[model samples]
Target: MNQPNTPTRVRAVLADDERLMREQLRSRLTEVWPDLDIVAEAKNGLEAVELVREHRPDLVFLDIRMPGLTGVDAARQIAQLPEDDSWLVPEIVFITAYDQYAVEAFEQGVADYVLKPAERERLLVTVQRIKKRLAQRQDGASVPDVAEPAGAPLQQLLHKLSGQLNPGAKPNYLQWIQATVGQAIQMIPVEDVLFFISDEKYTRVQTARIEALIRKPIKELVDELDPSLFWQIHRSTLVNARAIDGITRDFRGRQMVGVKSLSEKLEVSRSYTHLFKGM
Candidate 1:
């Protein structure tokens, strides 16, 4: 038996880069609302835009990351539909691995966002929320307004990001160490160290002392250091973020960046090139 002319039923579109997420959501949606029609599925945010424009589904489930545009970025774009109330704006539900972005998405007027590997019970709740909104729509009501900006709370969440330096941990942050230059030994600050150069036998800390012998290998030191401050430029070299002063293009269109403390240039390998762009 079928419910005929159920104009109030929620028709939806689904978008995610992962096939498993799409399939799982499809099955879950069927379990929750057997009558709900999923009109289309998109592989990426760009395609999601095209699909929404063409199919005009009543709802969409979008992923945060894909090959091209991100779901959050895409949602901001779709929310810009013509101001005239020619057609009701479709409801949206975001699915993401990162919980930190939930505040931003919620602020952007998405009805609800769910973390991936969604439990069936939670999915039903979201469906119920949608139903409640639509019931009001059938009678005549405005959608729920977004909660107040969570910018302050977001700062705490964003602080979970990696590469924080804890100077008090074990050994002192190794500020000043002795290095042998020519015939004399000189003291140097760890901050002044441009890079650590490693060899088969030992590692040299290239501070203003010209190059000091470090007790720890470059590999071991990288593990202990804050990753944001120091980058492993090569298997043999670890560079300080502050030490880099300028960049240059080689004849081959590759890059070689120079450090402030030393005359020697550092090679930017393809794998590590993105670090320079971020800088």
Candidate 2:
């Protein structure tokens, strides 16, 4: 970690497969901290490692999960570089959209971490600390514990892992999904659904506007909704995007995705706007 006032130039490398996440992160990092130079950026772990060796940056901000090798695997490779390896050991900061590492990032010796939708203030704070740590390392100072916040993040990650392990083998995006209403259960094809609305407790699956209450949460239902056609307009609703006639904002300026086959309109949250990439 470099001293806060040190004259050191920070060399960095960034990695993520999602083009938006990667480009945005790099652009923001460059804009905010002009002293830092980004040597390379990669779309996957293998590329990241290759870049790491090529550039030998002083720090790396990495996304842990990628198609080929995980961020952790890349970290291990960084950790295992032989003494004769010409590159100096660089510090690591992790970034993730999933809450999977909110706890583990801290537990590990990682320099820092930022959750998705990182704020400018947070980025400034993180960058300062990283530079400070690098300065301290160069000055032969002891590294302080930058452990993660305990308990809650870990619990959330465990729950997520369990959910993934048990993510119903029966994918929700099927043309038909199992439904139970007042002890009468059956599989309902998507074509049968008139619309879906989120209630405080459960999502109401309506067919022809006759509501059938189901216990499945909307988050899980998002996966069930066909990504290619169905869209989650709001946290409370999932609408068949293809079925959408037009989108209009309501009296409050909140956007709604309206369907052609049904009068009931659904909300579209900003976070899910990406689902409409082409449409």
What is the C-alpha lDDT profile of model 1 across 1-279, one tens digit per residue? Answer: 422223555678889999998999899889988979999999998999888887776778888666787675456455434323344546668787767555444553334677788779988877776665555444343323333221211111112211111224443245565666557777877677788877777778786546667556654665455444666665556788788888776686656778885678877644234334423
Give the TM-score comparing model 1 with the true structure, all chains together.
0.47
Query: Distance from true position, residue 109, model 1, in Å?
Result: 6.5
Misplaced by over 4 Å in model 2 are: 1-7, 83-87, 107-109, 143-279
Question: Which run of 10 residues does model 2 get worst, by summed lDDT?
Answer: 148-157
lDDT of residue 55 for candidate 2? 80
Tens-digit lDDT track for model 2 on 100-128? 56445554333367677666777887787
Top candidate when judged by TM-score against the true structure:
2
